[model samples]
Target chain A: MVEIEIDEDACVGCGSCVDDCPNDVYQMNEEKWKTEVVKVEDCMACLSCHEICPAQAMEHRDIHVAKRLYIDRKVNDVLDKII
Target chain B: MDMEIEEIRGTFRPELIPKETGGDIEDYEEALHVLMKFVGSMSSALEQVSGRGANAIVYQAGKRMGHDAAKMMEKTDNLEQAMKEMGEVLGVEFYFEMWKPSDQEGYTIEKGNETVVKLLFMDCVVRQTLRRTGLPQKGPLCYLLYGYMVGAVEEVMSIKGKLDIDHVGPNACLKTLTIKWGGK
Candidate 1:
């Protein structure tokens, strides 16, 4: 399981990660360019955004299946509506 | 310069490189134009529209006097606090933003005693609101301050390779700057 982290200060609000994520895990907040983790759990272990991000603002941590999988499933539940 | 020592230092990542392979002088100028506009837009949006002027105005903060109360910070001492109070009165702020190429993964540079992290592009903005205080314009001081920042950044870039960091445009309202890496 993977834990996703996004640095609000580092994020440029480019929306690249939002578009690239196949799992539909991120969304842009209205006020700022930063992405809000509306669905933390939907992350599919795919690191496309991690590799593609130009800002070096995103990171992931590998964790036990129990802790990691919970966020992944929780996020995916919300992903259906936004994506 | 000796009397005033108020300063803040920062670094940005991913050294910026030209998108094109080779070009003439016009190309270089155009690149700088694009870079300047990019930084200016970001700065204007943050300074003018964001309602975060206090944060953006670094120099103004330098002149502040007689502050009421705020929690003490461990990292800062009394003298530093006093200087900060003065800064608050002056209404000065320095803001920096950086853009860099992703492939290089960013790097750092060392100057006399400073180490600067390389960025694709870095913009150091100095906003001074003097309020027509009958004081001589501090434009030169602002330019000099930013010049030091650029020099530090260039020192870092030079270690990796020769990059030409130049002041592209200088206007009263704003200035345009750019650092071009690699030779034509």
Candidate 2:
């Protein structure tokens, strides 16, 4: 089951990835189409969306890495000021 | 500087700290170093690319895009070579030149005599895939890439307190070169 993850902050709502994916795996969410896990078996693991993400946002991971990276930005912002 | 950084780190993004690069500003600095190395390597490789007389312009955008990511990611693979090989496989040739305000071909100012580095990169040809994709077309790419580099220096790098970008290309023949800042 391929899970969909969206970092709304990074999702510029550009919708480029939606056009690139062939498996119909993503869709527009709240107008942005920010990385929806629409299909499980269809994922080709092409990394097209990953490479194309201009904001360094979005990724297909084993759910764990996805969750961790999702929070990394916020953490980095706080830590960046101190250590 | 250390004390100043500590004060700044006090307001950092806590969540990003532990996961990506061990939660420290020190690590972040190290990451930026790595990222710059990657970018430099990419820039160097671009010098060899030819662009096949295809009428193209290439430049780096989102000034911090390459820098911030470069600082964090640890690349074990030869991406420089990989990018080169990717060009070969795709039958596209590219060229790039990295600059600083102090280098040769470096323009000189009249009165103040202050030298400032204006970083830039340009492509010699537009790729077939890009042409078909309906992304921002080449003309806009030229405009934005130039503006983006100025943003990088003035905003991201914080080298200059304030700077403005100026463009001077879309030449009579095949290409365009945008000049950033007030020319000499």
Candidate 3:
């Protein structure tokens, strides 16, 4: 099962997610002008909404996170120390 | 910034197989990154030189490889069974599963002589390589996996098949695989 959360404060109501999601997992709350998850059952956790969301308001939980082997560990290590 | 290089000397014989592989995890990571860069460069250069023809070349190469890999597998007419076998063949590097919408009762839909199934690719090396090289998705490189899946399915089911990308994301990608029942 996939759980999605949208921070209302962060949501700008751009409807980017609503348009970008192929599965129709999200819809804009027209009254509140915020984004909401409408069809949670169909969400595949592709995270395209997360990428397109300017405010970064959405979060997905309990989904299979794909492996990110492209990241350079040494660069991250250096940044960890500096930050 | 400076590192030490360790060298191993061993005698090699055709009949004797080495039980252990040389180099550590770091070496492997370095090698993997280098290969990704090399492949990325090749894909980009090929695209620039060959234009759209690059995709066909890469797809043919992948199809040949897929056919070769599927040669040892058992042939079957069942799409689901063939998908299971393909999952094992693809392994974790290109992990994928049949997907369907909540409203759909079955994973597959039949339309006349054609059967269509949605595939959700969760982990993919081509995606990783593209990200590593800062290349966009749906390029010629993506056709490699497309051809691979189509080729494998064709070999396993003895039917003509095609795969189409529906969407691409950082974590996952969705594709549609259609098989023609008597198109072999």
Candidate 4:
């Protein structure tokens, strides 16, 4: 089963993930305005919500990490040194 | 900057068998990456040159490839069977599976003469190449898979089908495939 974690401190309460998720995996907590995962099983690990969330507060565990061959290794090496 | 190119010299003859391929796995990997960049550049240039029509051009090409690839598969009216067989034709690079929302009872929905199913593409080389080239989603290259699916489905089921992009994410993309069970 996919596990989802939301950082309330990092969450800006923008509701973008709530609106963008096709599976309704998230819902806004009316009390705190922070996002909460309502249906974890329904989450397909598409990661669209992560892109839409401005605060980058969501994390998914035990999900299939798709291949990202786009990242250039040399560029990453340069970035690693700078960061 | 300086570069070096190593040349391999080997005697070749038209024969029943060859001794070796004369290259290692790293050679293949380097070649593959170069090809990826070449293809990505062409896709972007095609889009810039033809505007929206580029999608149709690439789609037709993919549809033709799909038809050719699925030619050896057994034909069937069963949507699931056709999908299963077509999955092999798409292979692991374009990995995908049928998907549905939690509230949905079944993967396929039947209404009158049409059948609808959602497919979640998990590992798509086209998506990776697009991202590598810094192109946006749902561009002309995306239609390649759209036409490929419809072509395979049409060939297998002998029915008219259409695929519509529902959403695109970095990890996966959702598409709705609809098949009309009547004449071609």
Candidate 5:
């Protein structure tokens, strides 16, 4: 099962996730203007919402996390020291 | 910043088979990254030069690879069994599973003369390479996997097949594979 958490404080109510999700997993709470997980059953954990969210308000748990081989660890180490 | 390069020196004999693969983990990692960059650049360039034709070319190449890889395997018309065998051949790198909506009872669907199934690809090397290059989904590179699956299924079942991209997500991709009866 996929568990999704929406940070209400961080949510900007932009509705990008509501538009971007293919499975209609999210819906806008019109009254509050924040995003809510309406249909959690259909959420495939695609994480497109996470990528599009400017505020990084969403998190997905217990899902098949794809391998991210693109990140160069050595470069990251250097950045870690500088940042 | 200045980068340091370390060179390795070795003695080679023409007649003898090399026993060990020389290189540390860092070397392998560096080589893998370099290869990924090379492939990413090649795919992007091919797409730019050949446009949509690039997909056909890449698909054909992937199909050829699939056929060659599955040639030695036992042939069967059982789709489920063939998929299981193919999973072993593809290994963990291309991990995938049959998927259906929660409301649906079974994975396979039959309509008319076609048998359809949805495959959810969780970890695909092509997807990784695309992400490495910062390319969007549903590009020509995606066709490679589509053709590869079709080719493998065709080889195993001795039937014609097609794969359609349903949805592409960062964590997973859903593809519809339809096998047609009778010819090809």
Candidate 6:
């Protein structure tokens, strides 16, 4: 099962994830005015919400993290030395 | 900086096969990146020149490839079996699986003469190529996979099929495949 964690302190209640998720995995908490994971079972780990979220307040755990081969390793090595 | 190219000298004969490929992992990585950039440039240029027709052209090309790839596979009327076979045909690079909501009883839903199934593509080469060139999703390149899946299903089941993109993201994408029963 996929577990979702939302950082309420960072959440601006923008509801972008709620709007972006195709599976309705998230819903806005009217009382807290923040986002909450309602249906985590339907979450497909697409991570589109992370892109749309301005605050980056959510994290999905124990899901298939797709391979990202686009990142250049040589560029990362230079950045790693500088940082 | 200048780099030296290592040349391999080997005698080749029509009957004899080479025991090893000369390239290393770095060579493959560089080749893959170059191919991605080339494909991305072609896709973008095609879109710029042909507009929406570029998608159809790419889709047709992908569909033809899919048909050729699936030609040797066993034919079946079962959608699930065909999808499993398609996973093998697409191999690891285009890894995908059938998806459904928690509340849904099954992965597939039937309506009238059509059966719909949600496919969650976990790893797609098209998505990777788009990211490599900073191209947005749902562009002309994405249609290639759409046509590929539809073509494979149609060939396997002898039925008309279509794939619609429901959502796309950096990590994954969701698409709905609809298969219509009866003769093509």
Interface alpha-carbon RMSD, every candidate: 21.5, 19.6, 0.5, 1.3, 1.1, 0.7
* Candidate 6 vs. true structure, TM-score: 0.93
For candidate 6, give the lDDT of residue B47: 98
**Which segments of candidate 2 are over 4 A away from where they belong?**
A5-15, A27-37, A44-79, B2-39, B42-45, B48-184
Over 4 Å off, model 1: A63-83, B1-184
In order of appearance, the predictions have TM-scores of 0.24, 0.24, 0.95, 0.90, 0.93, 0.93
Model 5 achieves a DockQ score of 0.76
Query: On lDDT, who's better, 1 or 3?
Result: 3
| Model number with the top lDDT | 3
| lDDT of the structure predicted as candidate 4 | 0.87
Q: What level of docking quality does candidate 4 show? A: medium
* Candidate 3 RMSD to the correct structure: 1.7
For lDDT, candidate 3 versus 5, the one ahead is 3
Task: Itemize residue pairs with steric clashes in candidate 5.
Answer: none
Q: Which ten residues in a row have the lowest lDDT in candidate 4 chain A?
A: A69-78
Q: After superposition, how far is residue B21 of candidate 2 from its true place, in Å?
A: 23
Model 3 residue A47 CA deviation (Å) reads 1.0
Candidate 6 chain A least-lDDT 10 residues: A69-78
Candidate 4 residue lDDT tens string, A27-49: 99999999999999889888999
Top candidate by DockQ = 3
lDDT of 5: 0.86
Model 4 C-alpha lDDT per residue in residues B1-184, reported as the tens digit of each score: 4658899987777672555767886676666678778888898899889998999998998788778778889999988788788888787778888888878998899989999999889999889988887788899889999888878887888888989999899999999999998859
C-alpha lDDT (0 to 100) for residue A2 of candidate 2: 44
Let me know the TM-score candidate 3 reaches against the reference structure.
Answer: 0.95
State the lDDT at B70 in candidate 6. 83
Tell me the tens digit of each residue's lDDT in model 3 across A17-70: 999999899998889999999999999988999999999998999999999999
RMSD of 6: 1.9
- The worst-scoring run of ten residues by lDDT in candidate 2 chain A lies at A63-72
lDDT of 6 by residue, B125-183 (tens): 99999999999999999999988897888778889899999999999999999999984
Model 1 chain B: which ten-residue window has the lowest total lDDT? B62-71
